[model samples]
Structures are given as structure tokens and as C-alpha cells.
Target: MTGKGGTGKTTVAAALALGLAAGGHRTLLVEVEGRQGIAELFGLGPLPYEERRVAGTADGGEVRALAVDPELALLEYLDMFYKLGAAGRALRKFGAIDFATTIAPGLRDVLLTGKVKEATTRTADRRRVYHAVVLDAPPTGRIGRFLNVTAETARLAKVGPIKTQSENVAALLRSPMTSVHVVTLLEEMPVQETVDAIGELNGLGIPIGKVVVNAGRPPLLTGTKVSQAELRRGLAAAGLPTDRATVSGLYAEAKAHLTRRELEESLRVELAELGQPMVELPLLPSGVDRAALDTLAAELLGTR
Candidate 1:
């Protein structure tokens, strides 16, 4: 899932993973950009490079989590292809890994994406290991270039394993098996970013998935034209001794809610015009915890 940062994209990604697992798909939830978001959302410690089964679903499928560190991924790549088993440490100690990850961000992104692609295609006993792979990818701001490994590698290497690996990664991203879901809030800036990201992803030939509106507030005051006087009267009829302060506060709060709800509806209409599937996650009263994540998972999968 890719979205503007702070749009709860990571949380939605975790919920989607759980939802897929619950639906009988052995899902792998991978976190890139060095954020332990999946672990934190699952109420577990940071995940290691190796995948670990973090949560089980209702259908007996499993959700395994991994945080792909570019440095570790680089070492794993070297060990796999070059048999640099011991020299990997030497390379890290010589600050080569740091230089590559920091000084060359495109290379870092390639390494990270390469690891995710590997997990997605990895199999055991001639069968697929993960039925689905969900990546809490980089924010929408960087996701375009991050997933465009072919273009990035073309600038770095004319020919080699790295270039070839990048081409493969790009192919996977553009393939039918991969879908990029863009998450956003029902606000101006986030919705704008989500729209722009969709366009960018389309231009790059990456398959687009759902545009999820996270933390969506329901339209509580629907199907009725409520006046301020009617709101005051309704509060009074509730048998509460209404002081001037309390009534004023109540009216203000209700008005604010109605305004926000209207704005959200407008944004929702805007998103609908894009002609992509849109998912709405209601705002959780108890905030995002394990139970809330499960609730959201149910909502995401349309089980609730």
C-alpha cells in the first residue's frame, strides 16, 4: 500500500494483510522504508530480516511479517549470488553498505523492492509460500521512483545482475499479480496526493488497486435537515439540564461534525470520479489497537 504519510496507510496495510489471511490466503506483510509499522500495529516487537509468523486468521491461514532493511537485503543478495558469506561483514565494516544505502538512495530502493519481489515469488516444495504479499511501501511521494527500478538501474548499470534484477522487479510491478493500493484521508491535501499518485502510477504502467479512505468519519446527521434550534430542542428533550455553556458547546460540536461530514462526502465523490475501487474505513472509537485492527480487517474484507 502506498499513500501520503500520516494517512494511516501502514495501519490499513496491516489490516488488509490480516483480512487476506483470514480469507485463507497465507499472506506475507512486508515493511519497507525501515519502519516497524507492521510490528507496532500487531503489538509485537520489531520484526527481523527473516520472516516470522505474527498472527493467525480465522480460516487457519497465517500472516508472516518482515521488515526489509536495505543493508541486510544487500548482504543477502551478495550471499545468494556471489557466495560472499564472510566478505559480507567485511563489506559492511568498510562502510560500503552505508554508502550504498545513504549516498545512493535509488540503489537502496532497488534492494528493498528486490527483497519484496523475492518474498512474493518465493516458493517451497514447488508450491507458493505466500498466497499474497502486502507491502507497506514508501509514501506516495517517493513510490513512483522507488518502484521504477528499471529506469533507475538503467542509469546505474548498462548490463549486469543488478540491472537484470531491476528489470525483473519492474516487470513484477507491472504484472497482473501486483496491485498498488493508494490510501488517503477525506481531506484536501491527502486526497490530492492520492489522486496525483494514481496518475503517476498509471503513467509508469503499474497496476492500481483500491483507493482506501482511512479513518473515515460517518455522516451522523444524514437524511435530515437539522436546524440549530432543533438541535437545541433535541438536546433539551434528552432530559439533561442544559446550561447556556453546555448547549452552546453541543451546537458547535454538532455543527463542526456536520461540516466535516459534508466535506468528506465531497471528497468521496471526487475519488469516485477516478473510476477505481474505493474502500472506506470508519474511524475507530477506541483508536487502533489489536482489536481495532481486527475490526478494521473485517471491515476491509467486507465481512463486517
Candidate 2:
């Protein structure tokens, strides 16, 4: 999942993992940014560079999380392809791993994405390790370049192990099984970024999944106008004070809410023009906790 910063893409990604993990299926949630966001969201301590079970569904399904570090991934890559096990650690001690990733950032992306590819395709005893994998990818602005690892690494290595690794990653990303979901709010800037990101991914032949609208508020007060007299009458009828100050305050708040609702409705209309499946997550006034995540998960799976 990807979106503009502050659009709650990470939360959506986590909820998606939970949703997919329902019904006796295993799901892997991968975090490429070193934020430990999944751990924080799930109320766990810092996660190591290894996959660990973070949460489980009611029906024998589970969610495992992995925070992929580019440096560690590079070390694993070297050991896997070239058997540079001890030599890889020695290079790390000499800061060669960091230097390599720093100088050629494309290699860093390759390693990170390559690891995801491995997890997605990995099988044990003739069975896939995880039934589904959700990648908490970079923001929409950088996502196209981030996922297009082949293009980025082409300049660095024309033909080598790196080229082959990048190609594998690219192929998986462009495959029919893969879909890029963009999250956004019912606001102008976020919606625009979602549009741009979808267009970029389409140009790259990447499949577009549902567009998620996060923190969406239901329209409480319908219609264009609610006069002060109406508010005063409603307040009086409800056995509350009908003072001028109280009536004016209530009217102002209602007006503002109505205005915001109109704006959100218009933005929703604009997003509908994109011609992609859409999902809206309600604004959780209590903020996101385990229960809230469950709520979002159900919403995502259309089981709510």
C-alpha cells in the first residue's frame, strides 16, 4: 500500500494484512521503511530484521511482520548468491555494505524488493509460506521509482546478479497477482497525488487496486443550510437552554460541518472519475487501536 504522507497508508496496509489473514490463511506484512510502524501499530516492541508473528485472526489465521533493512538484505543477498557468508560480515565491518547501498541507491531498492519477492514466492514442503503479502511501500510521490527497480538499477549494472535480481522483482510487481493500492483522504492534495501515482503506475504496466479513502466522515447534517432558528427550536425541544450565544454557537458548528461534508462529497465525486474500485474507512474518534484495526479490517474485507 502507498499514499501521500499522513494519509494513513500504513494503517490501511496493516488492516489489509489482518483482513487477508482471516479464514485460515497466513499473511505477511512487510515494512521497508525503518519506522517499525507495524510494531507500533500492533503494540509490540521493536521488531528484528526477521519475520515474527504479530497478530492472529479468530479462525486459525495469522499475520507475520518483517521490517526489511536494506543493509541486512544486501548481506543476505551476497551470502545467498555468492556464498559470501563470512566475507559479507567482514565487508559490513568495513562499512562496505553501507557504502555500496549509499553510492548506488538502486541496489538498495533491489535488495529490499528482492527480499519481498522471495517471501511472496517462498514455499516450504510444497506449500507457500504465506497466503498473502502486504508491502507498506513508500509514499505515492516516490513509489513509482521505488517499485521500478529494474529501471533504476539498469544504469548501475547492465548484466550481472543485480540485473537478474532486479528483473525478478520487476516481473513479480508487474504480474497479474500484484496490485498497487493507493490510499488518500477526501481532500485536494491527497486525491491529486493518488491520481498522479495511479497514472505513473499504469504507465509502468503495474496493476491498480482499490483506492482507499481514509478518515472519511459521514454526513451528519444533510442539506445545504440549517438556520439558527432551527437550532434554537431543536435545542429548546430537547429541554436545553435557548440563549442567543448557545443558539449561535450551535449554528456555526453545524454550518462548518455541513461545509466540510460538501467538500468531502465533491472530492469523492472527483475520485470516482478515476474508474478504480474504492473503499472508505471511517474516522475513528477513539483513534486506532487493536479494536479499531479490527473494525478497519472488516471494512476492508467488506464483512462489516
Candidate 3:
């Protein structure tokens, strides 16, 4: 899924993976960045940059986790390219391929993409093992450029393994079976990125599925508050309490202060521009509990 950092993309991805796994799909949730979110959320700690079995779940179905490392992927790339025994040492003497690839901008993305492609093909005992791979991908800002690297590499290496690899990745991208969802909020920049990522991914022939709107308020105040001035005017006109009385009155004040009505309206307009239906998760309480995440999963899947 595409989204800005800290906009709940990783959280939503983890919840989705768990939900799918609980529903009896042999799912593998992959994290490209070194953020061990799936690990932490599931109470699994410091997962390796490769596939590992998930714990702390009630399901009997197969569930696995992977934290894809660009360093490892770059090594694998080198392994494919070099047959000489001295090549590894030579690369090490040159400050290693890790610095050249992982620290570099687009090369890092290429390595990460390669890791995902590897999981997509791996099978066991002549049987298809994994049913789905839910990637907790990079943020929406870099995703378009991320996918574009395949085409770029293909262009640079017009007639070899790079072109062949690009062809395969591009096929998987353009496949109807595979879908890219952008996890976002009913807010400003995240919503805008969702709109842009949907178009960019669609332009690259990626299958754009649902726009997952995360942690949205559920229409509490009701109708057109517009701004703080208008909201205060309306509240005063209604002759409600201007000062705190009961605990619930403070709750109302806090909600009114934080609520951004104009932001929500702008999101509606932006979402309309994109023309993709959003799967919205409700604004969870402080320190979101298990039931909250379960509710999120159900809401995301539209089962609630």
C-alpha cells in the first residue's frame, strides 16, 4: 500500500495480513523498510531480513513474516551475476555492494523489488505454498519512483538479465490478479498522495484496488461546520455549554477542537477526483486495543 510515513499504512497492512492469515490463507507479510512493525504488533521481535514463521495468533493456517533487506537482495544479485570466487572479496575490498546499492536511491528500490519477486516465485515440493504476499511497502512519496526503476533498469540494460527481470516484474505489476492499495487518511497530504499514487500506479499498468482510508472520524458532529469560527458560532447559537461541566462535556470540547471539517470536505473532493471507493477505518481510541484492530480489519474488508 502507498501512503505517507506514520499515516497508519504499516499498521493497516499488519492487520490485513493477520486477518487474511486467520481466514486460512497461507499468507506472508513482507516489510521492506527495517521497521519491525509486523513483529512488534504481533509481539514478535527483531525478525530477520528473511522469511520467518509468525507467532501470537489463534489461526491454524500458515502465516509467515519477512523483512527484506536490500543488502541481502544485492548480494543475491551479485551471486547471479558473478561466478568467480574472488568476486565477493573484490566487492568487499571496494567497500561492498551494500553501500553502492542500499545507500543509493533507485538501486535500493530495485533490490527491494527483487526480494518481493523472489517470494512470489518460491514453491515447495511441487506445490504452491504462499497464497498472498502483503507488502508493507515504502511510503506513497517514493512508490511511483520505486516501480519505475524496473522500466529504467530495463532501458539501461536493454538485452540481458536486467531486461528479463524487468519483463517479469512488469508482468506481475500489470497482472489483474495482483492489486496495489494505497493506505491513507481522510486528511490533506496523505489523501493527495493516495490520489497521485493511484494514477501513477495505474499509468504503469498496476492494478489499483481499494483506497484504504485509515483512522477516519465517523461523522459525529454532523453537517458543514466549515471552520472553527463557524463551529463556535453554531455551538454558541445552539446554547450548549461553553465551559466544562460533566466529563462528557470536556470530551465534546476536545472532539470539536480536533475535528477538521474543511479537511474532510477536501478529502471527499480529492477522493472523487481519483474515483476509487475508500475502505475507511474508524478513528480508534487512544492506545488502540485488539478489538479496535479487529474492527479495523472487518471494516477494511467491508464485513462490518
| Candidate 1 wrong stretches, greater than 4 Å | none
Model 2 regions more than 4 Å off: none
Clashes of 2: 0
User: What is the lDDT, from 0 to 100, of the residue 137 in candidate 3?
Assistant: 85
- Per-candidate TM-score against the hidden true structure: 0.94, 0.97, 0.81
lDDT of all predictions: 0.87, 0.92, 0.73
Candidate achieving the largest lDDT? 2
> Whole-model lDDT, candidate 1?
0.87
lDDT score for residue 203 of model 2: 95
What's the ranking of the predictions by TM-score, best on top?
2, 1, 3
After TM-score superposition, what is the CA distance of residue 129 in candidate 1 from its true location, in Å? 0.6
The full ranking of all candidates by lDDT, starting with the best, is 2, 1, 3
